[model samples]
Target: MKLVLSQEQRELRAAVRAFLGAASPLPKVREGYDPEVYARLSGELGLSGLIVAEEYGGAGAGFAELAVVLEETGAALLPGPFLATTFAAIALAEVPDKELLTAIAEGRIAATLAQPSIDLIADEVAGESATVTGTLAQVLSGMEADVLVSPALTGDGVIMVAVELAGEGVTRTALETLDLTRGQARVELAGARARVLGPRTEGGVGDRLAVALAAEQLGVMRAALDAIVAYAKVRVTFGRYIGSYQGVKHKLADMHCKLEQAESIVRYAAWAADESPGELPEAAALAQAYVGRACFEVARDHLLLHGGIGYTWEHDAHLFYKRAKTDEVLLGPPRVHRARLAESLGL
Candidate 1:
């Protein structure tokens, strides 16, 4: 239904926006803030253990609040691993396993979704805990994470499990990526000791995270579109603003439409997450499919709109491009979401 934010939610957004503005503005991203430093900042801002129960030293807000934090985080394009860490915290919250939740809530433990580029299957979780054998590439928050949330082939199907990053059988190798501003690591987790968090909540946790990710993508698109539009008005060509050009205006118009649609889907998905989880499988898939593609295209258009100067590392457009691509592959690829969307509707 009504996807508008309540006054409380709006206030929350404003507070978060202001806080992040001072603490994590553009230069923080350009300088590549360290996770330890960022996480410490998050703790100072009372975001480190935000979702854990109050008794456990967290704000106890729930997914809706997390969604707000993420949207603002994306808008600032702040370079931090909070998104992945917080998302993992959500999955951790749902796990009936008390020790895991306790560890996470105390903020003494850090966890990231170890979901790899490589797919995993079920029969691997018969013993004390599930096992993930692949080298999960681009693990966000990995360098600082103590536990990792990964897909496992469990008795109930494809369930997400929490594997300790420091487990005896695990190893990590940091990778250099285009988005050097953000942290991502490749972890070699052969026979890593782990605890299966919950049933292969693929369609739930994975899908829900994807929905939030769509929100993040939407924010990225907004930023990219804003950057290009602002640049167009000021960076004149031939004594006239480039934005006055027919082709440039048309391209900007198309980008604006895409950005608006992506925003709508992102808001709808957030509402679905708050009010109706089960009814959102298709909705989440749809949002991811549309938002992910739109984000990538918008960023690409941003690059083109900037001309030769956009290719430089100094410009922020490339960061958005890399983020969109990484996000596209994060929960599942666009094709995977599209396929799920079609299958859910029996098409």
Candidate 2:
């Protein structure tokens, strides 16, 4: 299927890019989470509600539109709980929760998926309430989230639950991370009360999250490549531009090729998430498998091209590098996606 951004989508991308460029400069992103910026992005830009239905006080857009916004946010290194909130919204939208959806759309409450590294299943479940007892090693925006959408093993099957983070038996500790722009937290849930949403079927919310993250990786790769290209044209060595060298030129070309491939895969994945549900599993896996590693390579090459300055803390190259590495492992990494792709293909 052909994937091309419509005129409206292009306009949306331009607007988001412009807004982020002005509002979320590199220094601002390094300062950590900004509530004011998050408010503007959700309230004014309506980004948090991009994929929510109109009846739920959202824009009623599809995953394709959400992909566009995420790509721009990634390029700008805009921080906060955007990804977590988006994933939570996607999960909540599947259930009949008007109040939660409305609050999420209005940016009144933030939520995230609480998948622990220790186990995918909840510690215990009795009746309608589930008890989550474990330390979630990495929770994106967990500290700021008001609610958490988690998967718990039940008598019937694994089920998704919406738990209030402020409830008793929940503790959130912010963690220092490689990418300060994207905040993370360690969450400990002990007998936390949760409202059951529904069954956790195969190829469900996880696939959607994979596609969304792939879109974000595309943004990171593109931004890193663009920055390096711009620098290559101006930075000179031995009385000649470094970009004039065949080695540097070839590296840039390879990076560009990878970026293009990643873009195509992410677009298809996003489209499949909206239109063809059956294809989502394969598409998401392929997108993550290719885009994740592609982004890391591009970001690493970008840092190398910048020479010593790229290695320094002052330069923004390091930030992108750190983000790429973090994102590589965020949702199971490239290897995991590749394995999933193979399994989906029966190979």
Each model's RMSD to truth, in Å?
Answer: 3.2, 2.0
TM-score of each: 0.86, 0.94
Q: Which pairs of residues clash in candidate 2, taking residues 3 or more apart in a chain or in different chains?
A: none
Clash count, one per candidate: 4, 0
lDDT of 2 by residue, 20-105 (tens): 98888878888878888888888878888888889989999999999999999888877889988998887776664777788889
lDDT of 1: 0.75
- Per-residue lDDT for 294 in model 2? 91
Off by over 4 Å in 2: 116-132
- Local accuracy by lDDT, each model: 0.75, 0.85
Q: After aligning candidate 2 to the native by TM-score, how far in Å is the CA of 228 from where it should be? A: 0.7
Candidate No. with top TM-score: 2
